[model samples]
Target: MSLTRVLWFAGVIITLAMGIRHSFGLFLEPLSAGGGRETIAFAFAILNLLWGAAQPFAGAWADRAGARRVLVAGALAYAAGLWTLAVPGMPLLGSVMIGIGLAGTTYGVVFGVVGKLAPPHRRSQAMGLTAAAGSLGQFLLLPAGQWGIDHLGASPTLLVFAALTLLIVPLAWPLRVEGIERPSQPVGDAFREAMRHPGFLLLSASYFVCGFQVSFVGVHLPAFLADRGLSSSVGALSLALIGLANIVGTWLFGHMGARHDKSRLLSGIYACRALAIVLFVLLPVTPASAIAFSAAIGFLWLGTVPLTNGIIAGIFGVHYLSMLGGLVFFAHQLGSFFGIWLGGRVYDSTGSYDPVWWASVVLGVMAALLCLPIRERPLQRAEAGA
Candidate 1:
């Protein structure tokens, strides 16, 4: 098969896996009721934590072996975890298992495959397409989950989603594996070299803010709308709109990253986010306005992924792309943990999400500023030689 066909196929499988995983937010209420709010929170935290922690290993395994083995095992684990979530009173274990499964299947393995297939010039666009597929999944699935909850109920909905994950196994079969040649530098040394790079640090830190904003809003936006006396459907629609908009956003950013200074583009995206959040808070909360805000913000959502991954690939080469990208994602997930957990804690304490909203705006601005001084050109010869 052609490279485009391979990418499109891989995109479908990765998007489905991630989309179903993210749609779990729709189950928070039911899961919380079954296991208690704290338990549910812990489960999600564990999920993100394990998912992040496992990426480096998964990436390395994929680099040394091939994504096929890791991805198939990951698909089984992901399906099993979703199935577990369907069982009553199994929230904690189910969530942790789901995280482990996600670690192997999602970003690391999928991107590793892309790194292998895509040429350097087209890498950013490939990442963009892949990320857009993930957003598409979010746009499509969250509402499906809501519908299932309202009409069919959460447990059955989850089971159905589990079945959907089985699709990953067959989809992964097309991945072409070229055998690994030994790295000129030791893997540990390469990792250390990446860690010490200024661009990598900036990319990782900026991604943290992206995670913070996206996770908080993704998890709480529906509830926030409900608290304002809007219908639950409004909240779901808002999220769906965001997911839809992200498709355009990611594609645009992917194209731009290929030609422009990626770091500056990242700064601009964050700056736009800060402005959007502030305006959203200031605006009236009408349904029309809510949908408008969701669409606008969604366009900016996940746009960072392509740029961030692109920078890593550009700076470091595809040989260790998955391992380094996984580390950056680890930072993103850590921020996600804080964003989701803190949003919940603050809501419980204050009965309002105003503080969290304000915090998001502030962090967004700070993140933009952080990206301003980032040097995006390839490393100096001396640095590269290291």
Candidate 2:
């Protein structure tokens, strides 16, 4: 198959995988009722942590074994995880399994595949397209899950997700290829080299804020809206609008990353996030305004994924793309842990989401500043030789 077809196929599968994984947040209330908030939180936290931690190993395995097999296994695991969710008292185990499934299936694997397929000049755009597709999944699936919950209830909703996950198998077929030989860099040395790079560290750090903001909002926004006496549908719509807006945003940023300075664009994106949060908090809490905020913020959402992945490809090489991206993603998930857990903690203590909202704004501004000093150029000539 042509590279374009390969990318398109990868994009579809990755998006669906990510979308389905993300929709797990919709199960928060139901799972919490079955267990407790702590149980649900712990389950999801375990998922996020495992997802983050497993990335490097998954990436390394993909690098050695080829993305196709890893992706296939991931899809199967994803389905199994969803099936586990259908069983009573299984959220924690289900989440960990789901994390493993997602770690192998989504951006870390797909972006690595794109890095190998796409020419250096086109890598940014390819990453953008992939990220945009994931946003599209979020747009399409979150509401569908909500509708299923309203009409069919939670168990059936998850079964539907499991069925959707089976689509990944066919998608993985195109991705199967013989493994390519890589330069003989020791794994430890490669990781150490990446860790020492200032740009990589900045990229990882800035991504933490993205995780925190997204996780906190994704997990808590519905509850917050309900607290304000809005219908559950409004909350669902708000999340969907954000997902929809991200489609446009991811596409735009992808194009921009190819032509503009990625670090500067990243800085601008974070700055916009800070402003958006301020407006969201300052504005009156209403369904219309909330939806508007969701759309605006969504445009900025996941815009970082492509640029960040592109930066890794640009600085390192496609050979290590998955490993490096996974490391960065690990940082992102760490932030997600704190964001979701802390949002709940703060709300429980204060009975309002105001503090969490303001914290996100502050973190956004800080991340914007952190991104400014990133060196977007390739590594030193001697280092490249090494």
Candidate 3:
């Protein structure tokens, strides 16, 4: 019953954060001009960079202090960021604030709490439930964002999201698990240890492919479809299909993680992703092909999160899960930075996404090979008193 409540609250927080975040672009459009669209892009870039940059520190803080304090600050910052959307000359700054907020409110911290609270047997399931919750939010929010924007208008919608984000404050109280450090080692030392681990470095490096693949596909797929002479609706529906299918994908992989070796699973995901992308463009570009491809790709989407977080906890212990996971995620965000920018740059230069598509294939193969040799054994400190 206790775990149930904790998962429920954590789910709500993730759902709210993910759902409202997608809609931010809608409301921000009205605020652009004089390359304001580019301004928004730059702001989003800043947000992603800051979110990655801040995550490890946030994770470390959450590890040392209880999560409740960090969560409250994140909630407030999120609310304040939404409110900033209503202000003049504030969208960019709001992005910065929200970036900081996300470092606390997002997966590393929430899953760190979940990972700690879960018994060894059920840890993967807990992580799955959380990922499923966020996937559900993404599915629902796509249409909901359009409706809310049309009905509420930009300013009111921003205000509404601000109010909604505050709910995370109270919800955070139920999952305030404190950090557990090794009895003999300082928290900084745990991070230092990870910094030295080849497995940790490789794991972090592989996740960059994840961020790159997902962001590139998500951002450029619609445009790619258009270039192939497909209808815009085809592109839009394909994205929606990916979101809807992702819920099942995340849960399925999460379920699989408990019974199988997570490293092999991660490798399989990247390999399958590579195969799917190859088939997607190589096959036909019809609506049917598009939907099928989208669904296949979507099924692989976010399948990495639970398994990756589970592996990190399994290998390192959950004592510094958030901080360590945050560092890994920061690497993922940097990959995201390069993925989106490079995809656009290539398309503009070559008038084709094939080069980027081929790049995804190469990266996928690399990530697949990368995960195979990762040592999945728990860190030595895990067996000692913390």
Q: How well is each residue in 1-386 modelled by candidate 3, as lDDT tens digits? A: 37788899999898888666644434433555443244554565567678889989888888778678888998899889778866767877888888888888888788878888888778888898898777677677656654665677666767877898898999898877634443355777887898999888989989999988887777667667877898655765676677788889998899999999988999999999999999987987888999999899989988999988888888888878888899999988787767656666677668788998999999999999999988678877554464
- The superposed Cα distance between candidate 1 and the true structure at residue 134, in angstroms, equals 0.6
Q: lDDT tens string, model 2, 1-386? A: 56789878988997799787667667777666744455676677777778888888888888767888888898888888888988888887788888899888998988888878778888899889988898888888999999898899888899889988989987897885445567477777779999999899999999999988888888788878888999888888888888889999998998899999999999999999999889988888998889889999999999999999998888887777888899999999988888877776777678787988999999999999999998677775364565
Better of 2 and 3 by lDDT: 2
lDDT of 1 by residue, 1-386 (tens): 56688788878886788788767667776676633344566677677777888888888888777788888888888888888888988877887778878888887778877866778788888888888998899889988989998998888998899889888888888875555454565679768988899878988898889988888888778777877888878988898888899999998999898888888899999889888888888998879888988998999998898888888878877777788888998888888888777777787778888898999898888889888777656554354465
Ranked candidates (TM-score, high to low): 2, 1, 3
Segments of candidate 2 deviating more than 4 angstroms? 34-36, 176-181, 381-386
Q: Rate the local accuracy (lDDT) of all candidates.
A: 0.82, 0.84, 0.80
RMSD of each: 2.2, 1.8, 3.2
For model 1, where is the 10-residue window of minimal lDDT?
A: 376-385
- Better candidate by lDDT, 1 or 3: 1
Angstrom error of the Cα, residue 218, model 2: value is: 1.4
Off by over 4 Å in 1: 34-38, 179-182, 379-386
Error of 2 at 134 (Å): 0.6
| Candidate order, lDDT descending | 2, 1, 3
Q: Could you estimate the TM-score for every candidate?
A: 0.94, 0.95, 0.88
